[model samples]
Target: MPSQYRPQLLGWIDDLDKGTNYLSGADDRLLYANDNYCAFLRKTSSDQIFYLCISFICIIGSLFLIPSLIYSLPSCNNKAIYFLLLAGLVCSILILYVMIPELYQNLFTRKGCPIIFNRKTNKVYINESY
Candidate 1:
């Protein structure tokens, strides 16, 4: 049997793989799933997955902006912009907290292999160990 940490870490990796599969396989449906799908589906539901993906993208983008924002803060001389950046950072942190768990659950709750998609090549792979 795997150690506690090993399973948890593997679960996270599986979730990432499953998330990638969802993104590439059913792109349109996942993107435009209606209220029914969002409300009813468990684990890798459209909204949760989409939010997780968006949160990651936003976090990466925010990291790039952090340095510039910090450097310009003093010269900005504008309280509003500073407040906006602070608010954005807080929101991004919150999103990360919410989405990461959901992503992990979505990936590891199932018994089958973790599914991954290569968007560039539009190919799918199943990772059984996960």
Candidate 2:
């Protein structure tokens, strides 16, 4: 029967309240929302848009490389070209499957965990339960 933890419970509640206050009334939320909006608008704020643009460029570049690889097939050695084509195809597929989805989720998804930022304490907390 070691369930008599009143003091611990009170402390936990206090911490929770403080965290809630910080998250609900901080500049960090506005910053996050602003950054997200800028990303959506394809505007410049930080390096996030640049990184995404670079990914897009890579995807397009890989697509173009495929055709170049095909065009050079007649003069190129069979085994080396085949391996290069295979590797390029695999990389393109991975970029489409893994990287794109993750980027989309990070930039778009807003229904899952609520990220809490405490500017007072400079702490960030994620509430995954809600």
Candidate 3:
């Protein structure tokens, strides 16, 4: 028999419109609560600064390395090895550029919290970088 799920690449995701499973975050995730409404943060409890910092460092390092590699290439002792090293750096940089579109927003411009819920309206509003 075929599986009920419409399986997709990378992740197995459910149809958002359907309430598929018994899922809820902990009370500690709550920001505030009252008679009218409540708000909660959906971000993971674990710190993500390290990952973001690493990506940021990669961006900075690539920017600096590419120029210096080019500048020193002509003066290097072994042209063949210099060209090979430059090719490696360029390929790595190309990979980084492909990843930039998503990473840039997360690294620099992600201002809003991950998610928000309102009991009064019985609705969820999401304004997340990811």
Candidate 4:
């Protein structure tokens, strides 16, 4: 149904009725629909490759600090210094292992993202990059 109060020159979706959006196919944005739920793909960033390159550059720049971190490695005979260095190493490894993989997840988000809407709960669920 056409909106009775649509704005002039503005493409605002004033029509709350859902009877017109029936298109659904692989090439269409509408992915699925049920009695109380539906999903549609959203447009992603236009510069994904640019951001991916920047992400790689940032990762490489962060790695330059690794050499400096190991520069103060203690001699094998100093127990206190050795234990401190060991602890630092363990902490660094744990941090990197837990966080670095999260950076790769958004590299391809430019393709598309599915946003789900649930009428039963009147809520929306968005997919996180991580």
Q: What is the lDDT of candidate 4?
A: 0.54
Candidate 3: clashing pairs of residues: none
Candidate 3 lDDT tens digits, 12-34: 11223246642243443455545
lDDT minimum window of 10 residues, candidate 1: 32-41
- 64: Cα error in model 3, Å: 3.0
Candidate 2: which stretches are off by over 4 Å?
1-44, 67-77, 102-114, 117-130
**Which candidate model has the greater TM-score, 1 or 4?**
4
User: Quick one: best TM-score, which candidate?
Assistant: 3
Q: Tens-digit lDDT track for model 2 on 64-93? A: 765775666566668877788777767766
Best by lDDT: 3
TM-score to true structure, per model: 0.37, 0.40, 0.46, 0.40
Candidate 3 vs candidate 4: which has greater lDDT?
3
Minimal lDDT window, size 10, model 3: 6-15
Question: What root-mean-square deviation over C-alphas does model 2 reach?
Answer: 12.6
Ranking by lDDT: 3, 4, 1, 2
Candidate 4, residues 73-111: lDDT per residue as tens digits? Answer: 744568887777777766666655644663575564524
Could you tell me how far off, in angstroms, the CA of residue 40 lies in candidate 4 after the best superposition? 11
